[model samples]
Target: MAKWRGPRAALAVAAGAGVIAGLTLRTAEYPGMLPAGTPDPELGLGLRLVCAAAVLIAATLAYLTFARRQDEPLAMTCLPGLVVTGVVLRHLVVTLPGAARISPAARIVPGAGAWVLLGSGVVMTAAGLAAAFAVRKTA
Candidate 1:
């Protein structure tokens, strides 16, 4: 747990905070954030912001509580936070006003950058959990 408790925990907190900041700066439903020609979906920016905030808070709490517990599972405590942070930050960034200006291809790409970020976040989270699980098993 030492590995997760120290650097990993700090990283998790940073990621969560980043996501929250990103979302506050750029709401998900804003135009020019999604890929070009993407139909205007009826999603609410307020809802996405709320959800992102929830994820950040949950992650922080998990780190402070479960992650700090002596016998707790590192994966169990940190996986959700890492995954949520990655996904949320990705969404916020992809949907930011300037994202489209940087890469128009992102809009044409099937599923767009936000989707890619979400998928990547899931994979990273799974990998982190697996690594933690393996360590526990070995010990």
Candidate 2:
């Protein structure tokens, strides 16, 4: 049988997940004003920019994780995983009920975008951790 893959496959998964996450965010109808004081067109543009930046960052990090060697420190291998986890946790905190108490509009309703983001985050985190484990195993 062919040798099993490692970080490469995980990296691809992460990239795909990031793309989906970005698209979801781009098309999703976020409640309330985005910047609080911006005009509608500017706010829309800003949101698009933010979405693009997020996707770029995620994809870049995934690539970086894949590029690291198996001999690298485990902490280094796990850095991207940690970052991804942080992003997901941040989103959850901002969208959950506690946030609603702070700002009613922030409460996340179950929508395609929200669901996609949640799913993508789960996949990205899992794949990142798996990649780190594979690196450790092969080191």
TM-scores for all predictions: 0.45, 0.48
**Candidate 1 accuracy as TM-score:** 0.45
- Tens-place lDDT per residue, model 1, 78-106, is 45545554545644555443454555444
lDDT (tens digit, per residue) of candidate 2 on 18-78? 6455444532344766445322221134433544555555566555544654323322323
Best by lDDT: 1
Which residue pairs show collisions in model 2? none
Off by over 4 Å in 2: 6-22, 25-54, 61-93, 96-108
For all predictions, the C-alpha RMSD in Å is 7.5, 6.1
Best by TM-score: 2
Model 1 stretches with alpha carbons more than 4 Å out:
1-4, 27-43, 65-74, 77-131
